[model samples]
Target: MFSRLIRAALLAATPLSVSAAPVPANDAQRGLAALQAMDARVAAVGERLAVRGAPLCGDRQMRSGLLVHGLAQYAPAARADAAALFGLGDAPAVLAVVPGSGADRAGLQAGDAIIAVEGDDVATATAPQGAARFDAVQRVEDRIEAGLADGALSLTIRRDGRERAVRVTGDEGCASRFQMIPATRLNASAGPYVSVTSAIVEFVASDDELALVLAHELSHNILKHGARLDRQGTSRGLLRAFGKNPGRIRATEDEADRMALYLMARAGYDIAVAPAFWDRFGRRTGFGMFSDRTHSGRRDRMALAVREIALIRAQQARGEAPTPDFAGR
Candidate 1:
C-alpha cells in the first residue's frame, strides 16, 4: 500500500544521478527496502501456491519461478534515485528467485539482468518514456512464454557486467503470474495474473491468512471467471451492479470462495483460517457490505467458508484428497 509515509518519502526522495552524492539514509532508501521485502515475501508465497496448487490448475505450464522488476516500474521522478540505490537497469531484472525453483536451480540470482530470452534480444526493446511502464518486462515475459511453449527456455543474463547463457528447464506450475502492486487499496484481482496490493499484504496477519487471499484470487483465474463473465454478457461498468449482473458476479465470487478453501488445503495451509480471515477483512474494509453489490455479505461468505472447511476437514480425516465441488462434480 502507498501509505502517507511512503508517499511523503517518495516526494522527499527526488531522482538524482548516480554520480551525484553518496547514498544517504533517506526515505527513498527506506521505501526501496520495504518494497524489496514485500517482493520477497510475495514471491515465496506465490511460488509455493503455484507448485502446490498445480494439480488443481489442471493445465500446467513451464514456470521459472522468478519475480522481476525494472527501473521503468518506478515513477519517472524516482527512477534515477531507484537506479542509483538499487543498481537496477532498464532491462527486466530478477527481484526474487524462489527457493528450489527452476531459476534457483539454474543459478539465477537477484539483480541478474535478463538481456535476452531464447536467443531473442529483449534488451533491445525500446524503453517506454514514463513511469510504471511494463512493456519491456512483458515483452521479455512473452518471449519466455513462447520459448517455453515450444520446448526448453534459455536466457542471456548480465551479471557482474558479464553476459552468459543460462539454460532453464522450468518446473511445471500454474499458468498465472503472481504480482504485488504498489497501492494503498486493500484489494486483489485475478485474470491471467493474480495481483495483491501492498496494503492487503501488510494487512494479512500471517502466511495462513495470506494464503487465504492468494488462493481466492487463484481460484478466480482457474475458474476463468473473467472470461466467463464476458461470455455471460456481464457489464464492466456501473451497470454491473444492476439487474442480474450482480447475481452473476456474486455467483462467480461464491464459486471462487469455495474453491479457495480447497486450494489452501491442497497447498497444506490451514483451511480453518479462511472463515475468520474473510470475516475480519469484511468488517475492517467493508468489502462485502454497503457499496459492494456484487459479493456475498460477510456473514454469507463466512458461512460458506465454514461449510467448505468442514467438508475439507472430513476428507482429510478420512485419508482422502481434499477437492473442490464443481458443478455436477
Candidate 2:
C-alpha cells in the first residue's frame, strides 16, 4: 500500500503532456481543449465502473462523477492562455460532469467554479512555486473526498457570474479514484487511484478496450497486490526484476489479468473483447527491459484470458454472476 501510494503521488505530480512539449499560444489552447475532451471521455467510463464495480470492492465511497481542472494544472507559459480559454480562476473548476451522475443530477455543469466544500473555504487554494500544479487541485480533491465520506456534500460554486449552494448526494462506489495523466506514454498504474495516460486513452479502439485496461489496474487495487508484495519482501525498485521478485511481480500481474475480466463483465462490458485486446497490447507494446521480466508473455497472457472468458461465458449461460474464481489467488 505504501508503494502504491508513493507511485500514484509521483505520477500525479509529473508534468502533463501539454506541458511536456512547447507550443504556440493558439496551439496551447487547442491542446488544453483536446485534453479536457479526453478527460471527459475517461470520466464517463470511470463513473460507470465506479457504480458497477462497487460489489467487488470491500471499501466504498461516494462517487460524484465530477472531473475538475484548475489554472495551476497548466504550465507557466500556458497558464495565462488556459485561464482565458477555460474561464478558470485560482479555485478548482468543473471540467466535466458525467451524465446521470450525482453531480449532474444535482445541477453541476462544466465550468462551475468550486468555492467551498461543506462550508469550508477553498477558493484561495494554491500550489507551491516550482511544484506540480496538480498539487493545489489535489488538495481540493482530498477535501471533497472527506466531505463525500459523510454520504452527502454541500458545495458553494460560482457559475454564470453568481454563487449558489448545491447539495450533492452521490451513489456509493468502489473506493478508488480514476485519473487521466495527460502524458503521451502508453501506460497505466493502480493504487489508491487508477490512472491511464492520454496516449493509451487514444490508443484504445473502443471503450471496451479502455475498460480492459482500467479494470486491470483497479483489480490490482481491489486485490491489495501492493501490500501483498510488500509483505513478501518484494522490492519496488530496480531489483524488482531480479531474484524471486520477478516471479512475484508476474504472479500479481497474472492475477490482475484474471480479475480484470470479471470486473469488466460485472460492469456490463463484453468479456469477449479481453483476449484480442491483451494479445494486441502484449505483442505491440508489452516488451520493455523490466516489463519482459515482471509480466507474463503475450501467449501466456492471451491463453489465460481465453480460459477466463470461457469460465465467464459458462457462468453467464447458467444465469449466474460471472465471478472470477479466487481459489489459489
Candidate 3:
C-alpha cells in the first residue's frame, strides 16, 4: 500500500500535456474551418430552403437528393486531388446529406464523390490539368438539373474506391438557387441565386434566424432590388467602393425586410425570432454599427421589423391575403 501510494504521488507530480486546443487558429486552419462550416451549412440550409421556399415561391414539381459538392464556386481547392479534398470532405465530395432527404434515404454519406451522372463522367471522366476546379462539377450539376427537367437522375458515387449507382428524383420548387461561400464578412447576396457567407451561417443562433437572413436576401431577388437600384441610377460600384448613398441602401433594406416578413411567414418560419436576432446581431463586434453610408441605424432596423410583423399580423387577422407591399419601387 505504501509503495502504491508513493507511485501515485509521483505520477500526480508529473506535468500535464501542453495542449494547443482552445487557442488561436492559424490562417490555414481558420480558412479550412470556414470552408467546412460553409459546406455543412450549405447542405442544411439548402435542404431547408428547398422545402420551405419552394412552396412559397411556387416551384412544386418534385426533390433532388440533398447532395452537396465540395467544389462549388466558394471552395475550389477540392479540384487539386481527389483525396485531399476528400479529406476535407469527400473529393468533389458529397459535403452533406440532409436528414431523411432523398440522398439520406438513398444511402449517400458525406465522404462520397459523385463520379458519374447517368453514363457521363462527373469531372471530364478524369481530372484535367489547368481546368477551373468547379467547371466539370458545374457541368455535372447542370446535366443533372437538365436531365431532371423531365425525369429522374442517376449518379455513380465513388467511396473508398468503390462505386455505387444512386438514382435521384428531382422535384422542382422555388426559382431561387442556393450557394455557400467562404467569407468572413456577414454579407449575403441574392439575384436569381441566394448566396450566404459561411460567417453568417455559423453566426446565426438557429435555422429560423438563418432563414430570416435568407428570406431577406431572397426578397432582394423577388423584388429585383439590385436591378431596381440600377434603374434608379444608383452606382453599384461606387456604393460598394465607398459607402455612399445611405438613403438608397436604406430603402432597399426596408423593402427587403418588409417583403421578408411576408415571405418568411408564408414559408412557415417564425418571424418573431427575427426581432430578437436583429436585436442581438446588430450589437456584435463587427456588426450593429450606426452606419449612415450603407445600412440603416439599429433602431430603424428593429422598428421596421416590428412594424412589418404588426402589419402582417393585422392583415392576417383581417382574413386578407397578406400581399407584400412592393408598390412604387
**Clashing pairs in model 3, backbone N/Cα/C closer than 3 A:** 59-173, 62-171, 62-172, 63-171, 86-90, 86-91, 90-93, 282-288
User: Which of the predicted structures, 2 or 3, would earn the higher lDDT when compared with the native?
Assistant: 2
Please write out the lDDT profile of model 2 over residues 146-205, one tens digit for every residue.
Answer: 888877889999987999999988888888887777666678888766888888899899
Please identify model 3 stretches exceeding 4 Å from their true place: 1-38, 55-67, 70-91, 123-133, 239-246, 285-292, 315-323
Clashes of each: 4, 0, 8
lDDT of prediction 2: 0.75
lDDT of 3 by residue, 1-329 (tens): 00001000000000011231112145444444445445555555555655655544533434564444443323234333323433323235565556555566677676667777677766433243342344544555566666666657778888667888888765555556566665566767776447776668878888778888887886776667777778877765535424445667667877887777776776567788878787777777334333434666566778988988898898889996556655732
Candidate RMSDs in order: 5.5, 5.0, 12.9
Q: Rate the local accuracy (lDDT) of all candidates.
A: 0.72, 0.75, 0.58
TM-score of each: 0.88, 0.89, 0.72
Which of the two candidates, 1 or 3, achieves a greater lDDT against the reference?
1
Assess candidate 1 and give its TM-score to the true structure.
0.88
lDDT tens string, model 1, 280-309? 888997743336478888889999999988
After superposing candidate 2 on the true structure, give the runs of residues whose Cα lies further than 4 Å from its correct spot.
Answer: 1-25, 127-131, 289-292, 327-329
Model 1 CA deviation exceeding 4 Å by range: 1-25, 126-128, 287-290
Among all windows of 10 consecutive residues in model 2, the one with the lowest summed lDDT is 6-15
